[model samples]
Target chain A: MTSTSTAAVHALAALPQPYLLFLGDTTEAGFAKTAIGLHDWAPEVCVAEWSLPGCPISTGLPTMTPAQARAAGARAMVIGVANGGGVISATWLPALVEALEQGLDLVSGMHQQLGDIPELAAAAERSGRQLINVRVPPRGIPVGNGRKRSGKRVLTVGTDCALGKKYTALALARGLRGIGVDADFRASGQTGILIAGSGIPMDAVVADFSAGAAELLSPDAAEDHWDVIEGQGSLFHPAYAGVSLGLLHGSQPDVFVVCHQPGRQHVLGYPDYPLPSIEDVIDLTVRLGRRTNPAIRCVGVSLNTHGMTEQDAQAACAEISARLGLPTADPMRQDGRFNRLLEACIA
Target chain B: MTSTSTAAVHALAALPQPYLLFLGDTTEAGFAKTAIGLHDWAPEVCVAEWSLPGCPISTGLPTMTPAQARAAGARAMVIGVANGGGVISATWLPALVEALEQGLDLVSGMHQQLGDIPELAAAAERSGRQLINVRVPPRGIPVGNGRKRSGKRVLTVGTDCALGKKYTALALARGLRGIGVDADFRASGQTGILIAGSGIPMDAVVADFSAGAAELLSPDAAEDHWDVIEGQGSLFHPAYAGVSLGLLHGSQPDVFVVCHQPGRQHVLGYPDYPLPSIEDVIDLTVRLGRRTNPAIRCVGVSLNTHGMTEQDAQAACAEISARLGLPTADPMRQDGRFNRLLEACIA
Candidate 1:
């Protein structure tokens, strides 16, 4: 097996058995996508499925009950539900509680949990179910492979449906490769607060990849599977962006950068649109860091211009760095100073 | 007027007209309270009610047609719904669109956009009604106040809610007061993104506040009302923090500080909690600002601890600042260096 594969296997092998479960419902496509991603990272992990009972005509799929899920010997469970309000009802809570009471793990394929289901959060806390939240992009976005080998160490990038998080992840990974760091992008399910890559089953390969990140960035910790990078374009999506800071906290990244586009969705009523200048971002970062965790040593800033010209993108980056009083370098063309700074801190 | 009344008037007079709205179901307490606040703020601003014909409730209230609201010169409108979910029926959208189409202003008591009513965000955008998003905190908290004033300057503090925004806001406000800054706490509604001021009509206040903020802070152009300092919270809540930011972007401020806290709600299914550090918040702030406007200059950092002693708080603050590379100072005590910094930036 490749080193990445071996590492993922090792991480999965080290994990306690029966600690994870996978829950499936009508929106199996979305669920399967995320499950597949999780499975890819940790192949040896066993997942239990409990389909929702009384399949509504809308979805027309059988669902498993809490008892069935329990019978599957799942200590942890991942649930994927169909979209639409009717499907998320009080009945689901009981099943969820059952799993949690039995000390089973819990993860969700719910897109953006904050306003979507307040009860779910309350229930999880009450039942002590370890819930991992996943937000599938608006649909039809490919997953990104974070493989980098070059210039500035593009350490982190996030993706969600249309937010171009995957693209950014890919770009960052590729950019890092161009700069000489072996970087790879991995999706941590939902990329916001309340839920992130925390609960889904990570295969051995994925677990090892997570371990590598933990070791390289935060070696003192046993393993860091919760550090979810901020997804792109989320800064502007209503109810999704501001609270993302909460998710970032859940993920525990050394440095977090929010990628944004200005004037693209200006009329959408998204709060973070007309993206703040780089300086503003840096200033806010420092302030937020001071309040959250002071131990964070370094923060790096990058820009995604949403298909803007290279000059425009560069100008934006330069202007942002100048405003924030931080070092700035081009990701495409290697900047040794910037890379060295990032490598020294993150590595 | 009583001191409370007088304060209310001063606050109201400080706001602009033709930019306010009321929201909530007619029977809901929020509707009545908001109406009372509006009456206190701008007695002359006409209140037009729109109700579905089939809805038999609240028959005595003054109801208006879409055209009547337009003709009555209603620049803002408020809707009272039963709960956060009531805003999403087909009946509500037409009237809302009518108001927006006819250029009526908007506000709501529910703490989240009526458009968030089910699939309304997508529908509204598709229908050409530019929906400004806002988020209110969840059910457990009260409103928030503005910064504390010490002589002529102000001090502000922030925190991630799970790590402690409420406590931080309260503590920082108290800290500012201790230092002789007449400080007060402000709630960023439910989502902790926007400041939830009591007894203030948002629409009426938005224009004046935005203008004032612009004149005081940027002055070059109109600021994003959703991005103002006090308007920093979640966008999903009905009272979006972005609206506050937008309104206050260029308005008054001698200093700005964002509080950061550790610990977060665990993601479902993750084996461990990904608690974000102060550094993560700092990085987030920087990125958030960059994604919007980068003009905000952070001058202070407050470390929020859950009921820690003064000594512990100070130690936490010191450690956090040293690690984040930001200067640290106690807002409770006056210092020439800090004073100099504030004076130079605000001036």
Candidate 2:
């Protein structure tokens, strides 16, 4: 028995690339951002997406079952959707339990703490698997003092709620890394937390410590490194604007990128609150950010053109660039421009 | 034993007015704000003070031992000072234990949770006495949405840290109440929590929840009533400005009172950061506040004149009123003027 376990451990260690099972079960419509972004990024470690039978595949990635995933040398199951209300569906529990039983770690950013659940935790313990909750923020985070830190920070803010702030931040991190720039992704919400392995659910945190969480996530990184902090909600969303301001103050970023979904008309719940013009957003961001950091500046605009025609997306990007006098692009398609703009701003 | 317990209960119930034993052991300079404020407020309910041997009596009230306190109809013990470091001193545990044994309810606003101490919990449980931790903020507080609520909110903001923001707020609440206005005191810190009977320690709450606490503390006050929300920290203090901003946004006050300690040189810890002029503070508060409520205004000034001569205090108040074209007063001394100013502003 000992020899068999040792051989299995050796086999797992010998695998050169770690495989991930992207769990996007029931991912459709409003909950598919994480899956779609992951599919677009095409991280080399991710092997295949998983979903329940009859569920629409939003990411268009290859599919696999828990057994198939384990057989393919998958080490972890990554939750790739912010499901409605952040609750893990009962259909996913069997898969999560089976994966744990097969020694595959369970990774999630759901507000419903997976590790705190009894059956999944017991299964993981029995199989020596780990449960990682990305949205569990660091404890005892101090209230942000707004003191200057050592490293450069690049925050991705947005024109409206869920307009690809996390995607822009992640893409920027990747582009900077491609250019040999030492950069790290600082996740600010649930989906970003799963993608980056750790983050604070800014909305879940107590109001006073919203900025404190942002500060803790992107603390004094080394002088040569860049901390790309993910943005949450938006300044226009009345329900979540307080969070946006707290994060802006806490991060104290020297430079920022504004993310927007072109042609979006109004904030989600309150139709009366129309989306601000691109220039208005830029001005508001700078004005709000500089209250805490006087030297703050906007370097670029990240456009989320997922449902738009290529021609329309290009037109929108051009218009934003011309009006705001800032470099603008779809970060996933034109990641290098975003990186270059950030480089210029920080330099 | 049953007869003796019954008689004791009757004796306690029959007392015309309950007495309070004020605890201020080890009280010294830099740790007497609570005692001093409480002394000045001079609540008729409190009967005597308790302090360690050789410690100066900052409140100038009568003194008593734990046993003597109970004999004098003291039904509760109030912690009367914000001790250094917020930790409960070991020297006071004996006194606390004796008081609990004597069946006196314990009230404190210290960060070191009184109920969490095993000995104190056991004693209180055994004697059927209550332990109140006033700074324990409400749980599951959602992020402030900056939505309009019924009634008027008047927040007290300051030019720098520890400038009597809480004292001014409490005094304003009292003055408004004295004029038969339905006004409530909302506490934002430990000392204020102790005085008001409940409040969130703004600094201890997570960043996102700071404003939420403010919102929760003064929720849906009646149309005829005014909620005087206590402010925390200062807009210019680097160490805690985020909290101040969060509270300001959360309260969504229709008007504000700018609290200043005239002639103060700088922010408490960072000497290089000088205190802003009164005009600068008022402008900053209004500008920051209006982001949430566009019609928000600063209608008055509350000055802390602790060390100033009476003539100097009057001159300072007069200068502020003349410069800002607003009512101004040392809330403790010129109580009626403060009340009238608040009435006029809300009216």
Candidate 3:
């Protein structure tokens, strides 16, 4: 089952009393739709649209005076500020803080982009509110019909900032969807998915690292602290090239396709900073499959057209595959070699 | 002479009409001292103490209403807001705008690091006030008069988020000051600095890259545009790495010492992802130096402790130096190897 389907099933079984409040402006139509769609399973779900006097959609709700909004009782609040630069005004902070004090299960400060409003975020944190970020997908990605299904397992990639990562992720998602897979993309980071759902708490680990955990721990201590690993470095850092290997360990996968863009090609190594080749990818896959369940299958690679042309991207994929001895294909092409590789892996 | 001294001398020689305003909870004594310092140079230099309401210091000067503060001004205005989560309020935006509309020469938004207040900054920008950030150094950097430098060198790192960059720049300035270089960091983009005292009308370059610039340029052209470059990546992404490199290049520093905690080592390769090693650093330095100016001199490196022990730090420094064929010395030690390397470079 797809993650979204699984989530829906779980929601139906539990009958969650999901209460979402749309604070500030009304730019987050996608989130509203998502919440409203779940209303059938969560009959008790309440979505209050709160706004100031001049705000467009000020009806069917109490005036967005902080006190009135606090009294409305929302388990989760998604605050979407108007586009441009109004989100960071001092006038918007008090109301935000008041909502946090009233107690909220989850509070997402939904701005088109967070880099534009650091003060608002800092204020939300000071008020003891965990801010969740919901980002729009990139322009190139075809927004799939929400009601359609393709019976293929989906993989999602998320990052903290919305604009750039969203573009790459949406493109990747669309590519996957084009190949008969249903991919659900979301923003993930301190102010997004990690903050919203029940995942490994990276913040606590970060706090432990900041509080001198490295020095205090004995050499023989079990590596229960995931923060140390994250802090030491990730696949993105040469200091932690081994991190990707570590993260992939003990995982069962039929096929592994790494997605990246030319601008960010260095992450997986390219040109001068080359790591193992396509052969390494196949070798790792086979080794991992044997180590885990022996049912593990194939390896494929996809390149993001972040700032590269189709020709350059295809060339890069070929080079990567040739070096590693793994199967290679163009992700953007519907019936391209990439889809063939994926089919081979799953078959 | 120090950069600030050079700047002060240049300012005095040019005799620009200095309209200065001090914000924050600064004491009457502190205000008096600052006022006296500037009074010696320009008789028209105005000092408004926003810390106290109705203080004679702010009496007749055009008072900025909250609404005006939020509007964008053509000229720059300095501000000092109370740190510690102090709200500047949306109401204050108009007054800032009014100040800009009044044909002020410059606006410096000074504030204590009370806490994170992004709204105040947005209001200042909306008013078109040039927001220059100022802050006290961090704890590890020795403050007060034991050091020769009174304030740090104000190097404007990035302009997208002045307050955030200010926080990091201030920390960096303090780190530099601790090592006896009187650094006063400023948070202005290259455009801001070019127009700071130039009196030239600013024209923002917003090219249609894919249409206009992309056809004639290389693949990196899309990544070079500030908007696209800024939008695409995280502080840890490779695209951002170019931005940081650009910032470093614009600063034209004698030496660039990147300060990073061991935990956040991901930032070392940051903006490009997969942090480059000592050899990569050497290569990058050579590439940047050759591209910018053949006469540019290369200097040794320094590492911020970030709470790492002296032994571990020494080992890391040594490893880095051995890889780069550069000498490694203790940054903290009075007679350390790094100190000697810095001394030679400065000489």
Candidate 4:
């Protein structure tokens, strides 16, 4: 009774590929942060999306059945929504169970551990499936002492929580590597942890030990290698500023990139709290960073212009660049403007 | 085979109190911050000290034995030193074992979990003695949202790390109660946790949740009760400033008392990092706190004039008070000058 169209099955045959069926159905499909991240990063590994039965509209990816997903060599069914409080919806349980029955692995970056759910865990266990929960921090992370080390440490800080700090850091790291630079990406959050293979989920760490996690991640790189540390939270976020400051102090970055989503008028969680101006965030970052490292500087801006026209993105980037007297770019846009940021970071 | 001094036993009997064998032999005696804290707060609970075998020149308390300590009604063996990185020394194992065997409870505010030690834990288990690890955080602490709460929260911040913020807050609380005001002391560190019997070891908490622990500890206090929130590390401590900021943000106090130890030459752990001026610390606290609550204010000064001449203490307090236009007092000196500070806080 499940829909596995022949056209969808044939589409799987053209490439020797194993992809992910990002389950962003109903509420998750319309506005999911994790799904949006996967949309950008998953194409390299995934070929299709899988929505709930009643919700067919995905974020423009071709929808697929578990059989077609298997035909296309699907490896895992990713719970791709940035679910509020990270609790998995009861609505999605049927699809998740079905996917496990189809011998697919389960992966989630939710705050609520998928491994902790008895049904999904038992299903994964019985079917010999791997349920990789990415939000759990690895143990024995040493407390950060904020000791300054050699080589430039570049961190991407944001104006608000979930404003694409990880995306900016990764993209900047990739862009740097493309230009024959030895820049290593240091992941500091869940999604970044999943993509990068190694990172500390900053939010998951205890407060006093939070900085230590940052210190461990950016251990002494080679003199030529720049460790691009992914930032967490924001200095202005009422709920998360402590973690934000902890990461800022822990990394002891010499240069920082202020990442901002162009259209965010209010803080994501607290509507009453207004987002600080880009200038305010940049000034705050420099002032706080300089408290430990006097030489620290804000070198560029990583503007997340998602869902914007190319002309709008260009104008926003240019306007910010002009106002701040710093290079600004949407790293994912690949409009060649990101080169300016790369040059600024190195310079 | 162990030595128990008769004279020490007589001294303890006269006091009719609990004595602590401050294990400050070896490295702990020279510069143990916790021992220093206990020295200031110990007269409230303890009357004697017990040093290691070779550590004869103790911190001025009459040395006693397990038999002598028991005769004197010693209830617990307090680990007096702030051991480097909060590690319990191997040298103290025999002493701890001896104390445990003598039907005494083991008390430590160390970062190292005493419950994790197989030998010590097993010894405690066999003896049915309690091992009070003061630094263990209560589970399931939520992230602090920095939501404004009712009640007058007065936090005692410091110009540098370990400058007697706890002593100041406790003294202020006492002074407040002495005047018939309803005041509660909220301890935020290990030593304070021991003294107050309730608090979060703020430094041990994971970075993101650090603020949450602070939030939980100083919840909506009674309208008539002034929650005297004890502050932690200094804003200038290079290694611990993130925690300092976290505690600051988490408390979101309406008013703060700035604590300073006269003539502290350098930042505690870092000789290269000079301590910021009292004005600088006050300004920093206001700036940081104002980011969350615009009405936050620096109300007074808690100057620690320990080891100072009475005349010098008065002069120092007067000079700081005059220059800053704020009431400043050496809370421990009990010079009754704290009345001015009390007036400022309540005002």
Candidate lDDT values, in order: 0.38, 0.71, 0.33, 0.74
User: What does candidate 1's lDDT look like per residue over B112-176, in tens digits?
Assistant: 45545544444444544434333321211111112221222222324322333333344445444
Q: Model 3 over residues A34-114: C-alpha lDDT tens digits?
A: 333223222344445555345454324334444454456555454533445324345655555555565543333232333
By lDDT: ranked, best first: 4, 2, 1, 3
The lDDT leader among the candidates is 4
Arrange candidates, best DockQ first.
Answer: 4, 2, 1, 3
- Encode model 2's per-residue lDDT on B31-72: one tens digit a residue: 766666655664665667787777765567678776777888
Distance from true location, Cα of B82 in model 1, Å: 39
User: lDDT by residue for model 4 over A1-347, one digit each (tens)?
Assistant: 01111111111012122445465565544446565565665466665788776665465678887667877778777776765567888777878888888877776678776766778877876787666665655566665555677777899998898777988898888888889999887878777654554566788776666667677777876778898989988887766777787778778888999989988998887776788999998888887788667888998899888999999999999999898899889988876678888988888
- Alpha-carbon deviation at B273 in model 2, angstroms: 3.5
Q: What ranges in model 3 sit over 4 Å off?
A: A1-182, A185-299, A302-322, A331-336, A343-347, B1-19, B24-77, B84-255, B260-298, B301-347
Report the C-alpha lDDT of model 3 over B90-145, residue by residue, as the tens digit: 44455444454554423332223212345434444454433332221111111011
**lDDT (Cα, tens digit) per residue for candidate 1, span A1-347:** 11112222211122233324333345445534434433433334444445456432222122344555456555566554445542444556766666667666554445334224566556656765544433312211111111211122222332212434343444444445555554444443342111123322111111112222222221122232222232322322222332232222223345554444433433134333343444444444444333224444335554446567767766876775676555444444345534643444345
DockQ (C-alpha based) per candidate is 0.02, 0.30, 0.02, 0.36
TM-score of each: 0.33, 0.84, 0.33, 0.77
Please report, as a value between 0 and 1, the fraction of native contacts recovered by candidate 3: 0.00
Model 2 chain A: weakest 10-residue lDDT segment is A7-16
RMSD of each: 18.7, 6.8, 17.8, 8.9
